[model samples]
Target: MSAVSRLWRRAPLWRLCVYGTVFFAGLAAFYPAAYLIRAIPSLGKLHPGALHGGTAPDASKPGPGPGGNGGPPGPGDGRISFLPLTQGLTRAVPFGGHVLPLPAGVWHPVLSAQTGPNGAMLTDVYVRTDRGVVSGMVVAMGTAQPIPDPNLLSVDSPCHDDRAYARGELPSGENVVSCWAIGATPVHDAPGTLNPVVAQAVDRLNALGYPIPPLFMTMRWMHLTTVPKKGVGLEQADVMLSPAAPGTIRLPVPIDQWDRGAIAGAPAAAHFVDRMRVWAQEWAPILERGHAGTLDPTTIPDSLTMDPAAPAVH
Candidate 1:
């Protein structure tokens, strides 16, 4: 038995346990793609004002955010999801208060939040207020209702009454509100379009005397981006919607640039929020039939024409 005990009895214990189980399964598949895959990275590219949560598979965006609202269910009624407004989303989005008066901590969203109808988030928040670089509508509407903005105007909160659940003031002095329950721009709303226990049709303003338990964010509209006197160049920004300037459908959504192939300026502001959802469905019933007083200016109706080559403001 002297020949190394007969070569340990011809050693090959199951071929050395199959070459040590194929060398620890080849270091457990190349030691994590060769050294823990470059310290794990890759999810940092969502800033077209970034904000993506749900309901966007392609509803009607032929060219923005690569398509979401994800088509295939329109009159059947059912299914709605949308997101893209941040502050860590928890059901209250009133950036820099007074719906963005800046100054305390500044604000956000200069562009990108078009997800509309029922879930309607809308966007364009900027503020350096005291009347300088003002841009509003950091809106969110799971339907707090109150669009009867027949030229809103009625203020006091100056900067942020916690985003004043009702501040109002447009005809261009700017100042805005009507925000609430915004934590990803919510809204599954329909049954009465929203308001106390589902009450309905409200541009309602006996000085905005309703809503006590937060039926959840009304978030009407607010638009104004004029900055000239030789200072225009945010691609020439100049949009002015929401019964502004002596009213009559304050047109001016000239945008001209920033499509960068979509996803950020949201196809350059969804060609003006598809004309503000065709003015909240055909000018919110003629702006709630002139919201109780002085709003006679109406006329840009080629389906609220935002000029797809100019022709529809019939």
Candidate 2:
């Protein structure tokens, strides 16, 4: 027992409480700020091809790995390499007796279930960009609802009942199902118009020289899914494209004013279909191949195309 023991005994409880409170308060403030910075566009640097994930490396010229970045993985390399808004990275996940090719910045994993019994599993990813929000899902030999009929497509959102459905087959024979609908609500009625987080983000964006337009637009949703032979499984991607509603408050233009044919023929609607077709063509062959690794299935040892121990695909 020395001077240190005496000092410890004299330390006031109030002082300790103040220090603890400050530390916890700092932590509480830090996390939400970090999340918003990532979630909000303009808050972070926009990677190239924000709409389609970052632009893919030039196929004409040789580059490094899947993404064009050459050097070894540094500290910045995340565990999954699929972080939200991260561009120029691609991964192939094995599923449903096939592989799901995750497009570069376009598909960022939001949630994934651990491989369940008998190779049952599910994965969900999203791409939020200035034009729209795209959601991609993969169900590996698991039960999921079938694609909705055209009339029922809008049931999931505040969209009108009238929807347009389109179907086609990829070059590789995979089935493609698509539907589009217009949202029904107005922007002012949508939630989060007055949210403090949203307001602060808008202010920061404008301060950074990115001016936001009036929060109104025609909200359009397109849901597309690729079906494997016999409907064994599916890879689904849907996009909700808003013309004017850039921020969180997504309200729709009045349906009465917009002709039904006009909505289907809009430029945004065409763009959504174009993107979906590109994704379907790129992914169909990969799904039938049933391989996720860089090396060919024939070259790999144990003849295992996917994970050996986990049997990720059926």
Candidate 3:
């Protein structure tokens, strides 16, 4: 009835047998070859620690000698060796007229937008981790606006609206405000106006092969007054660590307010909150130095033989 049936009927018995064998073999080989082609590209972007089934070593921890665990690769390694997390981060990059510690690993630049007075700039860098969690930081320089104190927000507010907000003062007296939100305002949602910066940033990230989840939980820390004596305006940094979720959590009753402790205790948010806490403290001083114009990129050792020496934020 069909051409294949006609060929099968006319061919001699051995010819049919050989043709059938070749056809089945090629079919089997095609799938594996296709799978390999799809998988090979991701291998280059994988976290090195992922290969070993553990988290990458802390960036602050020094590696053995040259090109060791926490250090950048030496000359002999013919390929670009993957460093765990933010290790091998040896230089500060300029952003919005201030220098900031650049995140390593899969973290890449998303958007650097200037929508503030006098060309004040806001830069956001983000990455989708191997586990599908999204983590990143936003730095703003010479900005007139200050992060609102969460304590003053009304209880009816979705998040950062409770007295449970936490605050700490750095050794140099800069204020650090941290908060967590279970159901944050979605960056892009239907029936609402879309922010141009966020829209463009998402497009760029998608172009770079990173996918943004439809819904996510957010943990944020806002560092205030990093440039204590800036003549023009305030300099601030906001860091966010968010994990993707399949859908927004449903509540039995309307949420009147959110308590940080309660949110941190929730099973869905506990892990991300803990990681955010550790990262917030670790990044505070480095961000401070960068905003204060005290971190010099030139002093960072190429070999990463030792940590760079920068004055405490004043």
Error of 3 at 122 (Å): 4.4
Candidate 2 wrongly placed segments (more than 4 Å): 1-91, 94-97, 114-121, 128-164, 170-314
- Whichever of 1 and 3 has more lDDT, that candidate is 3
Query: What are the clashing pairs of model 3?
Result: none
Q: Give the per-residue lDDT of model 1 (tens digit) for 1-314.
A: 79766665687795677688999865543332211222331111122112232222222211111100111111211122121223322111232112211111223332222223332222222211112212222222121122222211221112123422222333332232221110111112223222111121112111133211111112233231223332111000111222111112122322222122331344434444454333334432332223223333334343332312111221
Ranking of candidates on TM-score, top first: 3, 2, 1
Tell me the lDDT of candidate 1.
Answer: 0.24
What's each prediction's clash count?
22, 2, 0
Model 2: per-residue lDDT, tens digit, 1-314?
79767666787785688689999865443322323423442322233222123221111221111111011111111111123334332355444334444432233333222121221222233332333322122222221333222322222222223332222332333343322222222223334322221232233334544333333122222222434332223333222223333332222343333233564555553443344444334343343343323434333233222210111211
RMSD per candidate (Å) reads 23.0, 17.3, 18.8
The most accurate candidate by lDDT is 3
Writing each residue's lDDT as its tens digit, candidate 3 over 46-80 gives 43332123221111221121111111111111111
TM-score per candidate: 0.18, 0.31, 0.43
lDDT of each: 0.24, 0.30, 0.36
Off by over 4 Å in 1: 1-186, 189-217, 226-314
